[model samples]
Target chain A: MREVAALAGVSVKTVSRVVNQEAGVSSAVRERVSSAVSRLDYRPNLAASNLRRAGARTGLIGALVQDLSNSFSAGVLRALEDTARAHRTGVLATSLDEGVERERELVHDLVTRRVDGLVIMPASTRHDYLVSELRTGTPAVFVDRPPRGVDADSVVVDNASGARSGTEHLLARGHRRIAGLFHLTQIVTVQHRIDGFRSAHEAFGLVPDPRLVVTDISSAEEATRVVDRLLALDDPPTAIFAARNLLATGAVRSLAQHGLRRSVALVGFDDFPLADLLDPPLTVVRQDVARIGRTVGELIFQRIDGDTSPPRHVVIEPTLVVRGSGEIRPTA
Target chain B: MREVAALAGVSVKTVSRVVNQEAGVSSAVRERVSSAVSRLDYRPNLAASNLRRAGARTGLIGALVQDLSNSFSAGVLRALEDTARAHRTGVLATSLDEGVERERELVHDLVTRRVDGLVIMPASTRHDYLVSELRTGTPAVFVDRPPRGVDADSVVVDNASGARSGTEHLLARGHRRIAGLFHLTQIVTVQHRIDGFRSAHEAFGLVPDPRLVVTDISSAEEATRVVDRLLALDDPPTAIFAARNLLATGAVRSLAQHGLRRSVALVGFDDFPLADLLDPPLTVVRQDVARIGRTVGELIFQRIDGDTSPPRHVVIEPTLVVRGSGEIRPTA
Candidate 1:
């Protein structure tokens, strides 16, 4: 700690504050201390002490997600919470809302507050900033998306396969004008889904019309607006593939508004709670949320239990939930 | 700290461990130390130190709710998170899952970890257990329901009034036989909603059919089963009042399955995302979740800012969101 302080030109207490995740330290000082620590390969003694307390843990884990209210994130969180509770641990859950700065700040807060581990749904494009915290032996399991610029344990569904299957389903239904609705982020999962969308078209010797694919939606409300615009086009899409749950819901609304729900087919990526109860019962590429969450919980706890193994990446396959909405044949 | 250790017949480090929320202390030791703490009214010096760091405070707050996966709870959590982030505070969120023991334990964990404050949607019947934490200068504000067996700041929507309005809407729709689908728990919020259901019937000089009011539903799936049974009854209800969001969704499913959605009127208690996009567009009693969450956030932050004022209770009234489903005319 003293060496890190000297190297960073800060007091020993400042280094301790940075390492412990306490507030009051300026971002610049935190950066300097973190750089110095990384340069010196400093691992906090506290993490070493944590490894020794095999049976006893802080009884708390942090769950950082894009949005806790979203069905996909919520389902994963519930599964993790149930697993943590069985072990008498409480989750310190927070939503990042896709803000890069917010994710960094909250991660710092959760660590400073001293959680046993973390299950992160990273919003930040890169996670190398967390290298110091990870090296200090804080077990982190990324969920829904793989970690960027830093290696860690992660649990994600096969986004590409899921998207391919949904698109294939639409193609099999003989829908030629299939529109792809996707979120705006450059997130790997979203990109993979878009790739799947295009690849499905290519495999069948059909080129996807760039105009039919709408991307860069920020919210479900935005999805509705984008879907409305797509429907307004002279050559409207006969089938729609929504890459996210909220986007799917938005497509449903737009289709309903345009009186096209029964005429145009739709497929969603993630299945939500009442998707089956929708007007036409939404067809979705369902990621086994409970299993994904369980995988994440297992990996995080395994590391907490002193596992020094190399980081593991688990990708669960997505299954197609064939409900009525996606089964709608494109009308002539 | 010395006195607490002495009184509890534990070492000072054990007491420190308990106070600092560190692991390694057994539950028995924790209980004894907590008891000693309560008996001696011991306030950890850390909390005092927290007060001195007023401007540079702990950028963490605890948010305890029933289930973060539930739409209502998730919405509340999101609202609180938005507000907290605006103030540079991170939420240490958790799900209580309707377990009293779990709520107590999680609360203990959050308090001992020294969050700036808390916003709780409590599962515990009584919150007198939290008197010590509150007394120790941790600001707490309850949401969705008022604290029982204790006086504290609270922000709750008038559940009874909202439910009554929904029931009355159905009554005014010329429905004589109305079924009430309710959740099992004796949660005050649920009870208030039930009371509203009954009072609405009484106002019209009618006796509610006990057989039609099916309660004890534990899950959204259970809500489906209960609604199915209600429909199976001889002279089934002409309309249904679902006292919760999940129950409402279940009721919609049941109605859809029975091919009676257009004929049977239904009104749900709490509004959920995409409620307006349902087949007939569900009419619901809207709780103004954003307002409620914002109010809770404001109160807790005020208390954290060293407001030693008397506890305040804020009750927001709910409004009926009338859509197609709830406005259905009874099939005579």
Candidate 2:
């Protein structure tokens, strides 16, 4: 406050730096300001004061999440908060809702807030806005999915390899009929997972059954319908690879309804809540959500700190969590 | 922007108001400014322009959540987003991690950004900071729990009634032995829920058992240990109440480990994803997350519009969803 600065014999700007706990304020000046603050009982409106100073940041960061209900996004948001807190920044999160228009609107909203940087988990086909932001030197880091048709720093999981390995594990157990159940996101990550699934079949010299792959169904209700249709076929796949958590839940529900819990093998893409507590625990291709969050946080900060190198895409490895669902023996 | 204003023969403030869609500017003037913007190809940094105005807002609202990982928090946040989008305002979210100091810091952050208003889920034991903000006539609505030690507009669940009703459901089922589980937060909502649980026992001519209550344990690992201790007791309760979703998961894990799924009836506070898909399906008290979010959003907007009436605390009723878990027929 002006009163504190007057008592401390420092500029209001200097008072602001000290109040915000920002670096570059001398210790002597900080001490004087503290004493002045105590003596005057000057409870400053710190943010308002910062706005009056030059180079004062809004202290807001934009986080673009795909779906808030998803456990993975929830975990990532938590991790991102932990990272953002250390830098004295706060997150403004938006759920993309799997719509490009919604994602664009949220991005526009963040930009209009003048957020110093962004951590976007994009679900859009065209990333022109991101490219333009990059050209204008807006600090940003794409997470979960990369910015297509643009060069930007990204933190992604090795979905293709994880899916491939999971399929191979099922095949190695002598099960040739494997199904791939995935969400209907247009992101490249989905394609990679599908690629991995197909590559596994290729490695085993088995022809891929196109009917076993399900896509474009958003909600659990639709997923249930799709899985039911797939299973009603004369020869349903013995093992199912659910590409996402929601799809996996739908498949599990169908399995339970059909009274085939132990008979049909399943390996889900993302982990879900209470997966381990089920009668036959779910096996999932587990992506290290916390690590991915941390890495993306680190990458964004690095980019913000004048890292002028080409945009880097960092891929984290996923592990196969072998549980009862993936190891079920097929009935002849 | 100055050039456009000069060309249009208008003040910079008038030009800004016209350009940014703020009220008070005439339609003719707005059209003139729009034409000038088109002619000059002058794009305004909407976020900065809104801030530069004296009384106009940046079309942004801040939401402070206690924890994003919690299902309750996430559900509320998603609903808030939907409401905000409908109102054409962008939401800036921050996670407080249930720390008073952190909540204080985030409030300051939003204030500095000059967010039009705030929808805060306060974590502080006292609401001195919020009181100060309210004194300054800053529009804010507290959600999930009322602001402690401060009078303000709030949207909260009837935790006591919900818990009491839940306990009564168990009591009516001929089970004298029942245990209560709750997260440890100095929050009044938690206490209210605990009170209701106690009230149920008191009504049934039974004394509250100290050994049957667990508090100060929130994390899954901690809950796991607490549930283990509860189950190992010489006279373990026939029914158990886990306060929140994570605790429910922990209790389920503990139950599964002991192979006592159907033997002991369980009820959880919050409904979670795939609660019904489980082997026995979970019984839970479901909070109206969407209704709560909408009410909080409306309250914040009302406050922003200068609603200075006596503070109102709106309590939404929660519903008890009886699934297979609580409906199990106890065989003595």
DockQ of each: 0.20, 0.45
Candidate that would win on TM-score: 2
Candidate 2 DockQ, CA atoms: 0.45
True contacts kept of each: 0.45, 0.53
Q: Which segments of model 1 are wrong by more than 4 Å?
A: A1-57, B1-58
Q: Candidate 2, B295: how far from true, in Å?
A: 1.6
Could you tell me which residue pairs clash in candidate 2?
none
Classified by CAPRI criteria, candidate 2 counts as acceptable
- How many clashes does each candidate structure show, in the order listed? 2, 0
Find the candidate with the highest DockQ and give its number: 2
lDDT: worst 10-residue window of model 2 chain A: A41-50
Residues A1-332, candidate 2: write the lDDT tens digits.
88889999999888878877999988999999989976764556434544566766666788889877578998898888788778877777778877788777776657655577788888886687665555545678888887777778889898899999988888887788888887664768888888899999999998668888776767777778877888899999898888888888888998888988889998888876678877689998888888888888888777666687988989889999987899987667
Model 2 misplacement above 4 A:
A1-56, B1-43, B46-48
How high is the lDDT of residue B319 in model 2?
98
Model 2 TM-score, all chains together: 0.89
Which residue pairs in candidate 1 have backbone atoms (N, alpha carbon, C) closer than 3 angstroms, thus clashing?
A21-A112, A184-A216
